[model samples]
Target: MSEQAPHPATGLSALLASTPFARAYTHTALAAVFAAFAVERIAGSVALATILGGLAVLGVGILVARRAEYSLVRLAPTTLLMFLAWTLTTVAWTGDRGRTLAGWVALAGIALIAVVVALVRDTLQIVRALGDVLRWLLSISLGIEILSGVLLDIPIPFLGIQGRIAELGPIQGIFGTRNMLGFATVIALITFLIEYRTLSVRTGVALFSVILGGVTAVLTDSPTVFVVAVAVALVTAALVVVRNAPPERRRVLQWVLGAIVVVAGVTGYALRSTLIGVIGAGTDLSLRTDLWSTLVPLVRFRPVYGWGWFGPWAPAEFPFNYVNAVLRESHASALNAYLDVLVQAGWVGLLLFLAFAGVALLRSWLDASQRRSVVYAWTPLILVALLVDSLFESFTLSGFGWFLLVLCAVRAGQSRSWRERMRSLDGPPGGVETLPAAGGVQGPDISRG
Candidate 1:
């Protein structure tokens, strides 16, 4: 008997070829790794890592296109707009020219992959893929936290920095900073809540991740993150209740509850320093106040374009020497994400970004009203939390944020189109499926039809 020859495409190769959803999951998972741990200081810069990653994605996209039967046009407008915004922002505002150009190229390339995913796959497939990716990310992060905790006595170089032995009592995780860790925890927490309605096992994992994230945030001793995360979570929970309540009472209840949440959040912010003191994190609050005071005048200096992408008034040209200056402080502010955008992109960029976001939010609400899909509820709420986080943290420009935004927009657009198509087929009475096919790919037996 002849020996059996090895299959040409085995293991990862076969997986990529056979499963589009898995391919998407792998791409996003790799992207997350780059986003979370790719340190520019150690190896080139963040921009360089993004460029290399983008190149790899572009290569895969090309290969996938050659083999798959799909239409890229489904995501054309979104892809075009995303590329345009990144390019214009880089050309017009970004101070570090090389980094800006590279960043824009990387973003455009990522947008291309988003388009491919959106066009080639259905909505549920995309969501499932993303869910899987997030699950894996949380699991890995959890394991790291556990290892770091157990090896506290070992003095491992990088792992030791993840958490102090004391901070690991109930929960602990490694993140760039206390605030970022908290912010990430909030994301996982919210995601877990959403998942709880469907996947109980995944929900348990997400809950564990959330607790770890929260503990890490507290350990960082950043009162701002802890307070902000709680506030945002409360608001999100309220929104979910309002959105999901009985239709008869939803309108009035939503308005009343929403107004209350707004008033409460505002009042709390006004007394944030006192609140921080109450929680034994007064110094962190005071420092943030000082930073805000410094940033206010700085915002007025170049109100239109503000300092331009990642600016304390164009660092490359000015050479920010005041290491002690409040402007040089890292992620310190009480103002929300919208204000953050205003300071960086100026009013013009802010308005454009808001407009894009507004459209997506409106579409999501409309879909929920029609009771079309659950994603309508989940995506918007996540977007809102992310937007709120942006004000206090510089997260909008992050790869994860951009990816989520584009993904939500694609889902919204597709859902809208699907609803319209269904309406057209239903005619006036609204109960029909046998719509005549147009002069296009009418399936394999078009001649018979």
Candidate 2:
């Protein structure tokens, strides 16, 4: 018998799998780990979640060190450091020291993961990674929803279905809440739209994913998510149109935008009640107002640094217990991200976070406006969506959403850092050699598109 020779295709597969491109799988896996934690009910054992997170952290640590730039001063903005410092400092004042310490550990872990992602993967790679993860996650959730709602005749409460599993549902998919699933769907839809616009090879698949994600959001029956999705879609389209418009019109457009925003704000204030009813939030945000009414008084106890972060409530545990007792509910958060931050870290932390978000949004938006590539647009759009979502959901406190926020902030900060460096080098501008203008988020890989 002739000796069997190794197949060329098999060798090529192995070669490709060993390259940095193959890190897409690792990125997807990291996302899955974060999703498991985010969708805790469906994620099985805590130990499994920890192990997965650990492995991903280790893998990403190694890869980031090998493949990307690493500098604390360059990558970590002052706002970020301030936030971390405040969070750590507050641990000292937390009532349940152990619990707060544990929380800090988890928070640090997530922060490290964000650094790894932002530093190692460029903008295009980040988009591809996000696309891979969203496609996988949405597909799984859709499959499970079909199994429970269509065929199984069983409610999988962990997966967010309850009673009457036979019909198409108010299913939450794998996210544990209808709004969460809807939020995820909105994000996936936007990402896939961007991907479809930029990448020709998988345009059909991306479009189909966008459709599936949109349908899932609609099925979730979350008015907030549906409304925000439409708003974001419109905003994204408008931004792209403006970006491609003649450069001379850009400044005029900016002035027009500012005027439009002022008008919109006035109109919204006048029609506040009517708009609230239109969105089905009811007059009181389904009793969130009541919850806030109760919680706001307690924030006065330590107004400057209200309560410490780390635990579910303030340290000394006086007012939180009282609030929970009064509400007849074991509430973990204020149900609003900003309000929660104010409660936990007080005015100082809240201000730091706001500055961080404001700077990040401004920089990312500027980059998106200047860059022609659709891939460069995701950062700003995602930031806008999250900012809108944060009003209704406290997702910024944890999960992949928080991780992405940190990543974008770091990237924006890095871009600003590079630009500043160029500016410093070009001091006394006459006779100085011209330096390359700092590029946008679109990485070198985007040229292939």
Candidate 2 Cα misplacement greater than 4 A, ranges: 1-30, 37-39, 42-45, 52-60, 163-167, 311-319, 418-449
Count backbone overlaps in model 2. Answer: 0
User: lDDT for each of the candidates?
Assistant: 0.52, 0.67
> What's every prediction's RMSD, in angstroms?
8.0, 6.8
Question: Candidate 2, TM-score vs. the true structure?
Answer: 0.83
Please, what is the TM-score per model? Answer: 0.70, 0.83
TM-score of 1: 0.70
Best by TM-score: 2
lDDT of 1 by residue, 188-245 (tens): 5555554444343464665665565455555555555665576566755665676667
